[model samples]
Target: MMQNFILCLQEAALTFTLKKYLYPTDPSECFINPPCGCLNPGQEFQCEDCPYLEACLSSFKLK
Candidate 1:
């Protein structure tokens, strides 16, 4: 029983770590090429009705 519990805990920890690595908790940690200058706080882009939406989305990359 204890061994199973330990395995479960390890699995949970690994899952959490993998998730953290796959998706950064902070938006500023994104790896975008050419950088989007129009990105507002909360990592939100003011792309609504913006002329650069296509270009911005094209170059956006997540680390």
Candidate 2:
């Protein structure tokens, strides 16, 4: 139950960030200032399944 709750929160955060922050502004669509070197912006990037979801959320440093 607890794991499900945490995953739900992760999904919520990723969805919000993608819709409100990354997609609207960045020309590449996403991967703005990615947390790690391996991540790259692309048309097929799926934030929902990414292991770096939390890092990307924090990297936004949203006010």
Candidate 3:
């Protein structure tokens, strides 16, 4: 069970890194919501171009 948990964590971390790279931005002023296309329901919907991303990151962590 512990190993499974760790694997899940690794997958999540990898997914987040991919998201960060795909959405690369440091400010909310530059941000735009990612278009609702292939994304799964309840997934994040922000572009990396936002000027407020760093601030938003903290909140996102809680999720």
Candidate 4:
């Protein structure tokens, strides 16, 4: 059961990463939403060009 849980987590992580749905200034700014379609991971190699998500990382959330 633990292994299954881990696998689910891995899959969710992959989906999230692949879609690059990291929070933007808002959901409208999300890449998968509108006006940002071309940057979908595996579809385009442009992750390096994106600026860091504003205050969305773990270090910021804990505060």
Candidate 5:
């Protein structure tokens, strides 16, 4: 029950972020991790580098 709720929230957040900033790309598109180092505009190379990790996870009830 809780897992389903969390999934719903995750989908929502990912959707919102995609809509707001990455509207040009399709959600099904998977981005490959850089072999050395690379960065997206206004985006950190990885989610681990994001300061909003805790907030985003908690908001989605992710473990």
Candidate 6:
């Protein structure tokens, strides 16, 4: 029973970590929400002029 409990805990932790990695936190990284919203790859937005462009690009590269 204890072994099964440990396995469950490990699986939960792994799932949580994977979810965090996939979605990420504060994807916007902006103080005021822009009209276009947070930048994501393949979206039509002024990424060239965005202050968070670098961060967004890095995140997208991970995908």
**How high is the lDDT of residue 8 in model 3?**
100
| Candidate 4, superposed: residue stretches over 4 Å from native | 21-63
What stretches of model 6 exceed 4 Å from their correct place?
A: 24-63
**Candidate 3's residue-wise lDDT over 1-63, tens digit each?**
999999999999999889867643543322344242323323344433333444455454555
Model 3: residue 23 alpha-carbon error in angstroms: 4.2
Candidate 5 stretches with Cα past 4 Å from truth are 24-63
Query: Which of 2 and 4 is ahead in TM-score?
Result: 2
Q: Give the TM-score of candidate 4.
A: 0.32
For residue 62, give model 3's deviation from the true position in Å. Answer: 22
Model 6 lDDT per residue over 1-63, tens place: 999999999999999889866553565543234434544534645644565556554676677
- Maximum-lDDT candidate: 6
Candidate 3 has what TM-score?
0.34
- Which should have the higher TM-score, number 2 or number 6? 6
- The lDDT per prediction is 0.53, 0.56, 0.52, 0.51, 0.48, 0.59
Where in model 2 is the C-alpha error above 4 Å? 21-63
* TM-scores of all predicted structures: 0.35, 0.33, 0.34, 0.32, 0.34, 0.35
- Write model 2 residue lDDT over 6-61, tens digit each, in one string: 99999998898787644324333335554443354443445445656444444556
Off by over 4 Å in 3: 23-63
Q: What is the per-residue lDDT of model 5 for residues 1-63, given as tens digits with 9 covering 90 to 100?
A: 999999999999999878766422332222233222334513654644544443433444433
For model 2, the local distance difference test gives: 0.56
Q: Which digits, one per residue and each the tens of the lDDT, describe model 1 over residues 13-62?
A: 99988975664354444433323454553355553444444433444443
Clashing pairs in 5: none
Clashes of each: 0, 0, 12, 0, 0, 0
